[model samples]
Target: MTTTTPAALRAAAERFGDGEAVADGSVRLSWHDLLTAAETVARALIAEGLAPEDRVALCAPNTHHWVAAVLGAQYAGCVAVPVNTRFTEPEMAEILTRSRARALFVVGTFLGVDRLARLQGFLDGVTVIRIPGEGDRPSPDVIEWDALGAVAERVPVEVARARADAVTPDQVSDILFTSGTTGRSKGAMTAHRQALGVAAAWVECGEVTSADRYLIVNPFFHSFGYKAGILAALLSGATMVPQAVFDLDRTLELVERERITVLPGPPTIYQTMLDRPGKRPSTLRLAVTGAAPVPVVLVERMRSELSFQTVLTAYGLTEAVVVTMCRPGDAPETVSRTSGRAVAGFEVRIAGDTREILVRGPNVMLGYLDDPEATAQAVDGDGWLHTGDVGVLDADGYLTITDRLKDMYVCGGFNVYPAEVEQVLARLPGVSECAVVGVPHERLGEVGRAHIILAPGTSLSTEDVLAHCAERLANYKIPRSVEFRTELPRNATGKILKRMLRDG
Candidate 1:
């Protein structure tokens, strides 16, 4: 369970050398292949002058190289900054600038690679390494990924040995950027101990084993993906299947083909898959959803249609990974109704008037990198990370997420949970996805408005949707108006971009 050091990967490589590590379509890498590739990339990075604690930005989609590059960076004693592949040039530029990254690795053919290419000028002093692609030649000043690995000398065992001697659990591992309701993104500096502790706790809570094959659909840029998906698999010696993007059909195929047992994703992903035409994988034993609220209807449909053994609802954030998880033994209704109790090694409490959820644990991020003022605001002097999510913990320890503190609204002296309203909208026929935000109101102080994406070939008028909500929810909880869109604005991890909705 102690996976604080990069040596854990070495351990896995030695123990499960012939076991599968990653599979992307026709390409598959066993533990031996993965370790060799990581070592090669690590040597290349070190040869390029990256030192211990240096920041290496990774902007690749989910691919074998993505995992390789991360493990390689860790092997070289460098901190990996996983960039959101969906970021605009300006956004990417801001993160690159903020992290003060010396090098950037990009997957070349994803939907937004061109946008990254457009920002090459913005990354003037930084080295840009492009993963190979067919239609495009390497841009000027950009180094080909394969070329770097070919010429770079392998890291001598002595170097790794020496660095390993000095590396400690408290050393910073990742700087994850989280955009809260206000201001620019803050870089949450997660330490090696914290990240590994989260992975350990997750492995324990989920009962993960070496026999499990995990399909990692969550973007590695986020802590949920890094600790929950990658590190958890590493600690348990489970095979990891990486998908750069979440395509419903392809995910289903991978699940069935790989005989994947453990699946972790947001509710949107599972909902999309249930709507797709396919047989659920027989080997899938546990289906877990988090990062957003799970609609009651979606949970019902997943169980009734997919026939998975259990559906678990989890809750966590960039600062603290896997804070709570509903156990498989919990009733299906309980799992569907709440985000579950606090996982091992974490304490959760509801705070102040709005009942914002606060967390304290070894898994909490060390602090925001180089921003003490922001860190002070986020983590109290006593060490709890203010999650900013409002919720209540029942006497029996069940944690029910009520709403995001920032997303709550007062409608004529009544508090309204936007998540509650959005959940209702999501259940309406033809609604594929939805986001709710509060807009200024003269009499009520604030009122809710919904931005919605309709399912393909389905449409509903604003009045119709509102009418449907009236049947299920109190009038104050219903959205005052609804806006239709082909797709809801989302961040890289498929989280609805409420800032856009608020700004609009």
Candidate 2:
């Protein structure tokens, strides 16, 4: 429990050796088994000529193999790059080329095989290791993941212990690519110490314990999923329940069946669960929502309707794992309205026009991978990460997010932020999800438009949505037009891609 270094796996192995570590449906592993798997994978990478500091890209879903490969790369002192599993072939190739990965661990499926084939030209000399399954076989040059285990001798326990202890907190742990809305994604290079720092802060603020059972619904590729969900659970000696894909029915059933104590995911997930038929479990202790903004109505429904013990909202980015979080004891209104106060060991401030949120702390990422200029631009010389978010802090210290600086549209001499309008639309009855974007206009330079997805069996017209928006929002902020879709385009992390709406 007194672990101070970045090697979280080592600490977990020593502290909770025989305890349940991870469970993915029928597949389960204890802390001891997890450690052994990681050690074996590490030795395999070393045997395959992978040197320290080399990049290992993991392109797979949230499976047991993905977790093993991540720990293995870290154990071998290599930087792990987790690619978004939902990315297209070209998109995956772009990330691989940018990271300049020495090797890639891919899932064995028709899509995975085809993606690898398309990436062959871009990969050039990079080695590809396929996770054995029903798929096209790779060339002789490519290696099978299972075969690697056969050739890789188990590293000595003493040597593995020593290597893990030698890893400093400042060493680069992973390069997580951000899902950018406007431009190409940037790889945020996070250090071991920084990641652990965020986990430690969460423990201090949220009071996580070893008895807690964390249900990990977020994709491991995202920072929130890795640090807040995985590392936090490991550090606290809690059992991690991973779901490869998010299904509302399965998630609720898991909570009831496993007696899951903690549920952490985006607001959409919580909303979906609320709409389901099952009632909240008596054992459910806390519900944490992050990654995207949550409407106050949803938080109120979770507490008043579902009777959850606690509903907490958080705000963070890949650069900083978690900067702000609403504690359980905080006012329900505060939890619903603001992103809560800054977590321990961090500072949040609004600068310039009082719309730009700035964060500074030890938990901040080192920089973007291979892009010093972009890094310099994001983190100023003063050490403040210019979070592109627009927010306001009340005199009582509650932080209320208004919009994103880049997402604001100038309409008829007034600024119309999409978040404000989207929040209004989200409040409409039968509206499942919505996104607002700026469209080109001849007179006002830009106009607001709303793309919405209604709940099943619910019907609404464009005029009805517009009327609902007009009642809650300003005239300028109201959507000039509305478009209904079966589903909104979302990234791997479930974040709606507003740019796609604009482009379409």
Candidate 3:
């Protein structure tokens, strides 16, 4: 019943052994190999003087190495801090400095940019370990990536497993920083119990198994990828195929070639796949979509056109990793419309009249790292973490997220939720997608600005868009300005970058 991540992984390696556990570009590792390599990396870090509970930052894209680094840190009794490779130099520095990471495992390049070059100034005095990629030359200052295995050869596997088993559930496993959409990202200190609990719940709710070849399109830096994704795959013995960068064509080929069984990501991922309908493998069984509004039509398409056995939509945040997930047997309509009921271990409730979603569970984080004031503000005295998401709990305990409490804008002194407005735009004629943001108004404090992406060969005038909203929403809720664009701005995870819109 102990919920240590390393111990659980050791058990998985024992059971699955020679079965394929992970696959990168051309490299595939059996469970036994993967576990041994991870422990090797841990031993290497220990030799470099990383102490228990010390943080080691892993700054790289989705790959086999990223998984190994995280698991290796767990095996060494250190906390893994995953850096968002897409972040700017300052953003990455903030996480590294805040986590107080003494060692860094990073890639030289990501998405055609030299990430190692940018971090050179910030990473002074830190023990650097380079994950060698193509075109990367050997550096004397940085430790070679391949040396980890040789280092592990010196340390006994029994000693590594003993260190792993000695780790307590209360030990901090990882410190994940939230995407700073609203403000500065805070490090959420998550214990081994919380991480394993959430991963196990995701495997159960997402219906992932050893037979499932899980294609992880989501980045390893995000919770959707790290916990619910790669970790969930390991817990269930699913083979993890991580995609460093999501490309429509490449992803389709991988899914078909590998017969990916479990695939989960934001709605935009499915939208892109749906737009470019091609030869996809029939092996896709379960699809979980969340991190944004889940249109009922998208869910229907995934089930009917995409040939998935089950399509689920769930809602959670970096603080808890998972809260609600649709059961495997739930109605398709329910799965599409609601974010399902709370997971077995968590309790969810709408707080007072504001209807802000509040969660209380073992999955909730211990607190914000080194920030007691922010932690107190986020979680109430009653042990409820106040999730700033605005939602409505249906009669059946299902939650439908309407908008972020911060995203809601008052138009002409009337309340307007952008998700509600965006939903109306989605159903409008000739509209393919739309995002709504609040803009400062002369008369009102803030007014909704609608950015529409029209369907191919379709056109909608500003007058027509305003007229369409006139029928669905109140006069105050109607968007005053309509801008048509070829595409809306989105983050790596497919969530709209509303802050960019506000600044632009």
Candidate 4:
């Protein structure tokens, strides 16, 4: 048996043929139907003469068809590159050029902009395969999402099966680009075995099973959503319900209507649910949340008021899909405070002096695609991937991320990690969310300044926040000033845009 994603999909289909596999609003496909659709698209690629190992870019939102295209690429033995939906025209072109994607699977119109038009200059030598999203109409020079089956019907299905079977563990499965928060993004090439290991790890650590229903709100382009969210469901035989964008009311309705058992998202998702909580899903059994600081109170509420059987928090980067996950029976403090212990088959250690988190395991990427220097800088010569994020591995091996190396600043000879300060603020009364950045200070060279979000109808003065921090935190770690806002800005993945805060 192959360990690739396509192999997993076929196996799941055989076991759960009639069970729902993926749904995007109006369309919900069973495992067998979804697999058959993907295989049809795979054969279409072969009919069009797309060679094995060729690159195929999947640039779309969270749609069932997007899932089909990714599996199809795997069946065709082509490298699937998931492009960021939030990327601008230049960023999109850079990835298309960088990955050298021979074929492009793009959303027709997203956020009122034409994606195909967005890639006009970038399509100089690329084959465009358009997948129309809601409200999109037909145009020339693009293949319709459903038409691929009819076009590929001439090619025998066995040919696509043979191609999928020939895939090796070491071949590139996908090239995921980093968020490029610091600089230009580099494509992290993940092989079949590595990607499989990551997905399998999530299934085991997350305790996901066939009875679970996953509502995937994270964009499919993100590895968290692509590998851990989608592929993990395939591995566990869980039903997938894809949500393209996160609308609180709509999500609540979907959860209740579909009997969603497993829901994973960032802090924002839960915060919104807590604020509104339209209707508690009768089947909400588990919640695996990360990508932001989880206030201790939030975890308590999820397991109690939200009626989640288990609540878990995990930590990982794109280079490593899921490094650690809090276990099912962990205490609320453990789930909220730490990122849990390292997942099976991976080791986590803090650098000797810098305290930078280092990870080594089967899940680490092969390398940054076509960028040896960047690869060397990230993963050292000794095979340990030097994650730039600073963290502390407790005695029990539970890791608590303190801050990014780039985000740390020294104030009056004391180092201050923004996450540490932010956590202290998160516990403050009436605080919904907060961000801390080191601003230039003449006396100390730099001082921590906080931007805080207050809950609706709740008032928190800067004096109250500062006084609360003074009692709980050290002087150097405390923010020198505070600025209140309706909400903090976030990136596509729901991570706070600290750079934007600093720039402002």
Candidate 5:
């Protein structure tokens, strides 16, 4: 069995060989090519004197280099710390500092910004490897991506391969940082076995195969995009076509051009594709989405108009990816209403009183990196991970996420889950996206406030929103106030920054 990621790469190279592993723009690498590249990266790390389990950070987009760089770190028996590309300098610096990353693989430029230059002050003593990007210039003290081959020549290929073979399943493979919605982001440490376990489980549930081509629109930094997207493709032999940034036109073009068979993203991705100007024929077969409410109407539209045969909704956090996933051939209503039963060998049960979803599983994270107290609070003595989100499991084992525990607000002694309210608001015409947050109220202590992003060229009055909610929801459940915006603030993943909304 391929227990570690490096082992998986070797197995992939042996099995798939020349099969296309990654397709990023003009760059395409076969499985054998990918393995060779990763080995070269491992050799480079070895030459740099990075010890076993030492941290290396990759803060680039979902390009092929991001894929190769991370795999190379694993191949070298190093723990990869994937930094969010959307983070500000301070946030990036914090992660680099906290993770104690000895080397950094960052894009030279992205979206007219020099990401490395921006972090000049914080990158002291960190070995910087610059990946080619738009309008980038040569810099001192930074290793170019192509120059890794030369640095790697110092260490023999046999040495790197031996190091990769020695990596144990129990060793920490990667440290994935949380979105930090509540406070400081916690790095969730996942072992080689656990990471592969989740990917294999996702592969089983999604029915992924070697023939499938996966379009990875999700950011590589997030678990959904990294574990479920890149790693899943690696395990299943699916071709990974990464989209650095989500451009509607570019995504549609790639879907048609690449004959993309599997596309997984948040609900907004499908909705945006559905709302595109004209129908673009696609071969999209499987779509796994979550992170927010997926309306039944959207599911129906995705099947009917978007031509998706199987759409699965899944629920997971950074601690454990692929917790529950709706299986293939499930009814649209089933896919829309619930995130499917536990996969990845997870035992799921709702905590008695709080109704917080607790999971005990092989794929569950070992613990938060360097945060013992937080780790203790999250995982109990019984080995159940106390997922902070509130949810209910149905008779058939379907899991319905109600809301985050912190997002629930009491109105006149009545608890209102923002998800339920948001679901109702999603059905409203002209409502492109909506978020319900509890705001300070003098009498009720807390009242729901709706922040809406209207569909383009569409308009809705405060009364229009209130009247619609009044008809569907109870008086207390209705938002006391409504605010419209061009766009809602979201983190690296599509999850809304509810804390920001609440603060506003």
Candidate 6:
């Protein structure tokens, strides 16, 4: 039985051997080749002086390098910290500093931005390894990805293999940072057992198999992409075909060319495909999606038009991924309306008068990294992780997410916390008071709307506010609309009533 991620990788290599493991564009890696590459990366990191249990940050989009780098980090008994590629330089710098990452595996260039060059100011005492991207530029200080083999020569391969074998199930495997109501991102630590356990649950629930060719369109920074996309494929021996960016034309071309079997994405992806004027035939058979609400029509059309045999919606947060998922044969209404029942040894219950969703399971995160007070509040004494989303459970035990308790919203399948946006908005020169709220958006499920009150005699245009946000925040977190007001509505206790703002 596989208990850890590295073990799962090793088992896949041993069992599948020459079977294709990753197919990224022209680069194809068999299971055995993947293992050899990951081992080389492990040896390189060991030689680079990354101690066991130290943190290593990866800031890149979905690619073959991401898969190997993360697995290599785990093989060396180090924790992998996946950084969001959409974040600004300052945001990325903050995460690197907060995680205390000893080394960074970053892309040289992506989307016309020189990631490594932009981060040069903040990478003190940290080893920088550059991954290949679109624009070709080399820095003397940064180590090239291909040079890992040379670095590995300094450390014996046997030592790296022993380190991979020595990895225990209880060791912290990854630190996934998620934003909270406090306007700060907290690193949610997950053990090797927890990570693999959730991936196994997702694989079983989705009915993933070795013959499956999974198209991972989601970004690797998110849990759904890494745990459900990569780790689940590792456990099930599915071929991973990662798409770094989600272009409708490219997605359709890949679907037809690669004979992709499992395609999991947000509801918008299916809707867009269905609306395409000239849709291509696809081999898509299974889809497990949830971030925004899945409409019954969308679910039906996915089966009818997109040729998906199974369409499942699931509910999960950074703390406990794959908490609830719809089964293969569930009714369309059940699949569309609810997030299915609890899986992976998790027990779900609606707690308190607020109807907050509470989950308890072996897969619950160990804790927020290095923040005991925040961890105590998140996970109670009874071991229930207080998922700050309001939900309802029907007689059949299916959970329907109705509202959010954290004032957080999902924008284009990414979590956008209002507090985080408000914090950024407050930094604007003319902004005296501001409250951000999630408003309905046709395409992006929900988007932020900033209600601002400027200082006396100070004026600012919407363009200025948006421009300021564009520089500091990710694209999804930037408010879609800005409303200037004289004052914000508040209760007697002086707390701004965000519900009123959202309602208006």
Residue pairs with backbone atoms closer than 3 Å in model 1 (clashes): 62-244
| Local distance difference test, each candidate | 0.77, 0.76, 0.82, 0.83, 0.88, 0.92
TM-score of 6: 0.99
By lDDT, the candidates rank as 6, 5, 4, 3, 1, 2
Deviation in angstroms for 241 in model 3? 0.8
- Per-residue accuracy of model 4 over 1-504 as CA lDDT, tens digit each: 347877888898998889889877788899999889889989988887789899999988888889999999988999999987766676688889988888999998877768787688778667778888668777777778878978788899999999988888889999998634334567999998888888888888778998898999877888878888888888888988998877888888889888898888776677678778355556788888776667799898887777889889998877888899999899999998999998848999999889999999888989999989888988998889987889998889999988777676656433466776777788887998888898877545578999988988899888999998876554666899999988788999998888889889
- Candidate 3 lDDT over 1-504, as tens digits, reads 438888878888988889999987799999998887788888887777777898999989889999888998889899989887766676688888889998899997656767677777777768888887657866777887887777567667777777787789999999988633334568999999898898898888877889889999877887888998877877889999999887888888898888888888767777778888556557789988775556678888888877788988888878898899898888878987899989949999998889899999888999999989889998999999998888999888899887676676654323356876787788898999888888876445578899999999898899999988875554556898999888878989998888889889
lDDT of 4: 0.83
Global CA lDDT computed for model 1: 0.77
Error of 6 at 231 (Å): 0.2
The TM-score ranking, best first, is 6, 5, 4, 3, 1, 2
Candidate 6: worst-modelled 10 consecutive residues by lDDT? 273-282
Task: Find the number of clashing residue pairs for candidate 1.
Answer: 1
lDDT per residue for candidate 1 within 1-504, as digits (tens), equals 554547777778888888888877788888888777777777777777778888989987777878888877777778889887766565678888999998888767666246446676778777777876535655668778778666356556466545544557788888888654443567888888788888887887788888998989877876667788888878888888888777777888888888988888766667667767756657877777765556677777777777667788888877887899888777777887888898858999988786989999888888887889889999999898887788899887889987665665555433466766776677788999888888766434567898888889987998898888776554556788888887777899998888788888
lDDT of 5 at 451: 95
Better of 3 and 5 by lDDT: 5
lDDT for model 5: 0.88
Error of 6 at 381 (Å): 0.3
Compute the lDDT of residue 314 as modeled in candidate 5. 91
Worst 10 residues of 3 by lDDT: 408-417
How well does each candidate superpose onto the true structure, as a TM-score? 0.80, 0.78, 0.81, 0.81, 0.83, 0.99
